[model samples]
Target: MVNIRRIGLVATLCASVLSLPAYAQQYRFNYSKLYTQMKNNLEEGHPDVKVAFFFQEHKTSRLCKIDKAWMEKDKHYEEFVIPPSQELIVPLDDNLRQVGPLVYVNAEQGKTCDFSMVVMTKQPLSGEVSYQDIEQLLPQMSKMLDDLGGMFSSWFAPKVIGLTFEFDGVKQSAIQTSKGNTFSIDNGKAKVNLADLSKNESLLLPQTTFRVLPLLEK
Candidate 1:
């Protein structure tokens, strides 16, 4: 008989009749198992940082629900499922460039949802450029973060907020704070009132860098 298979395969009887389209295996995601595994893994890795996550797309994304009805009287079965290895992306930079190691999570659990985490290793802190010129300046910025954090506690604060203090060189930036009174960097200075800054003592201004720091309240 003339064997019409590929040369190499023909020697092996066409590789046992091509073996059922190379056995394309479709994975059925065990969502319960997968969600538990991912959550446990993240907790084990980062102990100190409390991670809270919310879904960008609720029902449409990972929380897809499918319902079916049977021929019996008032009988039906329903299930929610998502594809294996779905994408979870986060905006890493001011440019809004996204990066990911995505997965499906059990979002039905409310705040306790088993979210797919894309733990970013590190990112360059912006606005602190050349801050080494005045490394001590961080406490100033940190105070700003705390202040903004407090500010937010009082009202609905935006995730990204900014306060500036205008000096000769505008520290032009957004600052997150718990305090509602976010400082501003206007006219080359952190837009703080000199009267609120200090009615007690002189602010020994650091001359090394042009950016100013919010004065410590008396």
Candidate 2:
């Protein structure tokens, strides 16, 4: 079952650039504050769960829809054909910045929440493994998942509030979970549906600018 959750809209329409200069630059958004918030939420809700990330599909224009679906759903779960980017199960800490795709896991309101979303160009991906430790086959795991973009959110019978992520002192995203999945986000849009969006993650309406700053020197 594809469990979906809703958290309203966390990302607003900020300034958008028509196109990048010939020398495409990688922009970074300082998310130390947000990461700290996520860590706290993970503790209260996710416990020992590992949060991660994955890139969007290429040319089909599905990212905006995925992002939008992610905002409204409880579990924020969905499965799709992988484009070219990879998925990374990030380690818990306060020193990590944006990578390929970013995801998180937690137990909110007695439900399991999983979110896999990112804003990177579509590219081939590698390496992905089940959260369970396969000590016997440690050498047979890949760090990326190819051809499938899956975000699964499952809630249990016990009623509870899911983990949430706040930014700039605002509750941008929260996981209001039910027995199953409830909300979704794709194609970079937050309030639309899968059917209403394109199958690819290519630029559609416009690019959502996330100004990322490198704090390594700081």
Which portions of model 2 show Cα errors greater than 4 Å? 1-25, 40-44, 47-50, 55-85, 88-91, 95-218
Which numbered prediction scores highest in lDDT against the true structure? 1
What are the root-mean-square deviations of the candidates from the true structure over C-alphas? 22.8, 20.0
What is the overall TM-score of model 2 with all chains considered together?
0.23
The TM-scores, one per candidate, come to 0.17, 0.23
Q: Which residue runs of candidate 1 sit more than 4 Å off their true CA positions?
A: 1-29, 39-45, 50-53, 57-173, 176-218
Task: Write model 2 residue lDDT over 98-126, tens digit each, in one string.
Answer: 32223322211221122233222122111
lDDT values for all models: 0.26, 0.23
Ten consecutive residues with minimal summed lDDT in candidate 1? 6-15
Q: 1-218 in candidate 1: lDDT tens per residue?
A: 11111100000111111111233211123223233323422433233211112222333323211111111112332232332222222222222112212222233222221222221111212342222322333233333223323434224322211222323333454332223334444333443333333223223222222223233322
